[model samples]
Target: MAVVQADGRLWMTFGPYWTGIRMVELDPGTGKAVEDAPVHHLATRPDEPYAVEGPEIVEHGRHSYRFASYDACCAGVNSTYKIKAGRSASVTGPYVDGDGTPMPEGGGDLLLAGHGEYVGTGGRSVFKDRGSDWLAYHYYDAEDEGTPKIGLNRLK
Candidate 1:
């Protein structure tokens, strides 16, 4: 689980079925999490069934919070895998996409994915730099065929 601290509050993301990622807000005043707070569903589909996993939350600018996760569409048989992101002005949001669509039922641009050369890419670790951000993950080395190797790159 990855956590993001903002405005003296802690935010956590988790998935019960590995299909939908949800966020919970913690109240520092009571030292307990607010259960009734709305949980934001990470991904939703209208056609093919998909799962959202490996959720990471980060505080971007001063007031914006970004949420990231790996989306796996079509579980079996060469499933399409990619990293996606969404952001909100508050820690616990109604996160919106690049086009201002709500993430619970909204879709965003593909941050990273396989490009024919790489088989598939998912599982992401997002971290902050001096003032930038980076993403680290494992990908199947094309040269090695089926060998999985770690890959790291600046997210900018």
Candidate 2:
């Protein structure tokens, strides 16, 4: 979940702790942490278990996006993870979802969720290619006896 970034927007994928997700500017040539670059703390869940992870930042036109996964995952048929998203005008942000609630305040727009045999759809990556955005992630397929399946969806 390491995102290769320029424009001083380095998105680091983080995990079970959720708070571990950080945004820092890096030196592209050396792939090392840049000096004087402040690390911005991203996501957290105080009420439930800290299940958020897999952070990605994508710049689309005039807006910047923050993507994450929420809830439990990797439990096959029992996985409860789902994909969530937020957007900001700035790279290092106080991101707000579609409803305008702040991300650090447990706010995110639900992008993907479990349905029928598709259980726990999470672990996501986003990329912009050829003027189109693509969302890729993994989900548990109960129809196939809870096997892991890759899902690719075109996004706006």
Candidate 3:
């Protein structure tokens, strides 16, 4: 996932391997990551790093929130993916959940999960629309033969 910071720098986070996620700042003009920048590990789940993926960061007020997909994906109705969240005061950080659990230690508050006809609610992105923050993601619809569909929610 990518975000343009308030300082006008482009930053991104991604998992090169399903179990490993990293964040980096980029040189906007060159479209390349800053070589000397410190690497930030977004996935450090001791039990199952594979459970995490599709991370996105959003800045709100004085904090930056990190949202990510956890568990299995790409299985249609069988998928177990869900969304989790943590927040930090700095852009490159040690994000923590509401309970003060460090995210790098496999901690995050459940933000969204599959329920009813919605299966695998993951791959989320938060953005602003009409002065309100919105979450956009995709999920498999159990009532529709497990077809993938886009989902959106206005964050409060």
Candidate 3 worst ten-residue window by lDDT:
1-10
Model 1 residue 31 CA deviation in Å: 7.4
Clashing pairs in 3: none
Per-residue error at 120 for model 1, in Å? 1.7
Cα lDDT tens digits, model 3, 1-156, are: 655564567788877435656788887788788889877886656685456877788999998888888888889999989999988898777888989888888889998999999999998989998899999999999999999999999988
**Which digits, one per residue and each the tens of the lDDT, describe model 1 over residues 6-120?**
7877777777434566777877567466778766665453234456666677776754545454545333225466777777777666667789876667465678887655545
Ranking by TM-score: 3, 2, 1
Candidates' TM-scores?
A: 0.78, 0.88, 0.91
Steric overlap count per candidate: 0, 0, 0
TM-score of 3: 0.91
Each candidate's lDDT (Cα)?
0.65, 0.78, 0.83
Which runs in model 1 stand beyond 4 Å of their true positions? 17-19, 27-32, 35-42, 63-65, 70-79
Judge candidate 2 at residue 11 and give its lDDT.
46
Per-model C-alpha RMSD: 3.2, 2.0, 1.6
Candidate 2's TM-score reads 0.88
